[model samples]
Target: MINTYPLLRPLLFSMDPEAAHDFSFAQLDRLERCGLLSRFIDKPLIKPVHVCGIAFRNPVGLAAGLDKDGKHIDALATLGFGFLEIGTVTPKAQSGNPKPRMFRLPEANALINRMGFNNDGVDACVERVRRSRFYQEGGVIGLNIGKNASTTLEDANQDYVMCMKAVYPVASYITANISSPNTKNLRDLQGETLLRQLLSALHQARIALSDQYGVRKPLFLKIAPDLQANDFKFIADLLLEFEIDAVIATNTTISRVDVATLPHGNEAGGLSGSPVLNSSNQAIHHLFQSLQNRVPIIGVGGIQSGNDVRQKIDAGASLVQLYTGLIYKGPQLIRDCVRVFN
Candidate 1:
């Protein structure tokens, strides 16, 4: 696989990032269709991830961006992720921001994407999830839902609430994505007043939905990696206020502030890869420190190797996720990290 990745990577790299993703998944789909996925790729890819009231088979999860609409869940699962998170889905399907949207920073082993929240919508993702052979049958699948970019901050609660209400039935847990910097004014919703209101509304919706579904699935909030201590404090307080089940320490960082020496460091979009590793780790430590272990965390960003995975676990993350790391390290990284977890 290592020998083949170099050959395959460059071919996919030549295409646009978003297109490359579609192409790769399409290949996975075809491989699944051919029944060759498990025969070749599935050699003990999952361990077990017990966090936030969900039992994921492993700590290595495919981060949200790679399969945003849950379109390739089963195919992706066959590659051996212990868990999968689909969507940054909005209440409504959206085209998101325009293109040359996803940028690659090869030197830094990172990706900068302003793909916004392009998805087939929460209801659509839910329908796909419902039919899915993974999440539907109790394999671990988390849904990360976000507000439609056009929604106002004041009305954002309605969008989030709508998404939670729609996807709640199909998710092991629901993630609220308020951090992606690409969405205009979306991060503004993370401020004290707006953040609190949104959480309050989401929690109320969660309770009503849990009553409706007769199951208790956790509700987690995914936050930005680029924030000051005070910002983390306020957000942490809000998590406590809402009694949110867990906190995903980061989505991605907009601060090119950290990787000044890397090529394309000035790129406009959130940066996720090696450069933001420390930032996300520190954020995780802060959350653990601030919450006093009151909440479990799913660490993301710059996770490229088994050591990185162990660092996140040692830093108090119950589970860790990756996107750029998988891009840089290939599929063996997942198996390797699971070995470390064992």
Candidate 2:
């Protein structure tokens, strides 16, 4: 599989980034459906570990935004992730930003995406998860929830609450995605007062959903990598105050300093891949220091190699996730990370 990716790379690179993304997933799904995925994809063989009370086969897992609707879980599951997270699924379906929203910087091994939470809505996503053989086979699935673009900041809680309830019954964990830079004012939810309000609402909703379903689902907050010292401290404190299960320290960064001179570096969206590693590690280091082991951190952003994955763990990430790295390095990256734990 690793050897083949080098050959497949040119064809994928020639296509529009988003189109390539969709086509690749479709082909993976077809291969999986035909039972040929296992012939090429290596299954991860790391010792299982627990994070946020859920068991994971390995620490390497897929990040959200790649499979926005939970439609490709079964196929993606074949790629050897310890756990699979899908969506940034909004309460309702949305078309998301505009065309040419996802760009590739081959030289830097990076991507700039402002593809705002485009999906087939929470209900549709929930249905897809419910029907997934991988999900039913006990694959750990985390549902990442976000508010629709049309939903105002003031009403964000309702959107999260609605999506939470719908996904709670099926998800191993739920992520509040208030950190994506693409959504208008979405990052503002990270402000002290609003974050407390939003988390309080989500906490109450989680309790209700737990009672109704007889299963307690863990809740994680996905935050931006561009936070300052004060902002990071405040968020760590809020996570403790609200009893949030964990924090995915560092979503894509709004900073373009590292890639400013590269093509599409100045694009108005979150920058991900190699350039984001430093900022993400800094945020993880801050959160790990501030929370002082009270809250666990899932490190994401710019992880492209096993050394990069190890650096994140050494920086205090309990578990790590990858998106852009997978695109650049291919499925063997998962094997490489799993080997780190071994």
Candidate 3:
């Protein structure tokens, strides 16, 4: 396999961050369609592990945000992730925050994005997932759902319930994402009172959906990296109490301590990459201690190498995810992570 991203990095880096993102996925899709990608990349090696009752081919997955609407499942699958999580799709599609929403801090090997969960609505995302080869192959596909930016906080659960019902029949797992820092007041859902209410509604809905579809899908919660120890303890207890299947220990951090001096370090959005490695690991360790193995953890943030993935596993993650790493290191990072298990 040609694993050299160095030859291609400068061209991609020259474009605007969001433009580069779109161009890459589009090209990947084209390569996949033309049957050219397979010639350069083999299927990832098997390193099977079970988390949240789903059997994953490996412990490395492509995280949410990168493919927000589930539009690139087949193309992304070509790169060999054990699984792919798509969306933060909302009940209704709303254009996210204004332009210039994504920024790269190459100096810090990081990115800051406040995409605001902009997507083509839950129905559109569901249709794309249903049409994907990845979904048809019975590959593990996690659909990450969120409330609309326009939805009032008081009525957020409705959006979640609606999306859960729509995706339940097609998803290997469902992620209720309340952690993205870009959304106005979205993190408020992480509070004990609101989170309990949201989880209870979704739990009941999941049971009903399982009975109806004759299939049960695991549910996960994606949370932020910024939280006090007490807050994490409370959230962990809530997960056990609600019987939520797993937790993706962190979306992105609003903190910029590590990259504060770098260009775009002060950008208004969540910071992700090497800067978040320690905080994400700390969150996983804390959640593991609090959950006591009753719930699984999908650790992400600042994962750029096999060692970074291993550190997450050592902390308490049953599986790990990548986003910024892939941007910084290319598809080779996925193989690097899987090789760690080998």
Going through the candidates in the order shown, the clash numbers are 2, 0, 0
TM-score of 3: 0.98
State the lDDT of candidate 3 residue by residue for 154-193, as single tens digits.
9999999999999988899999999999989999999999
TM-score of each: 0.96, 0.98, 0.98
- Candidate 2 regions exceeding 4 Å error are none
Q: Could you tell me how far off, in angstroms, the CA of residue 297 lies in candidate 2 after the best superposition?
A: 0.5
C-alpha lDDT of all candidate models, in order: 0.84, 0.91, 0.92
Q: What is the lDDT of residue 58 in candidate 3?
A: 90
Residue 95 of model 2 has an lDDT of: 96
Q: Residue-wise lDDT of candidate 2 within 1-342, one digit each (tens)?
A: 345887899999999999999999999999999999889987557679988889898888999989999889998888889888899998889999989899998888999999999898999999999999988898999999999999999999999999998899899999999999999999999999999999999999988888998888999999998888778888988999889999997899888888889888898898999999999999999999999999999999888988998989999999999999999989888888878875
Q: Cα deviation in Å at residue 280, candidate 1? A: 0.2
> Cα lDDT for residue 339, model 2?
80
Please name the candidate that would achieve the greatest lDDT relative to the true structure: 3
Which runs in model 3 stand beyond 4 Å of their true positions?
Answer: none
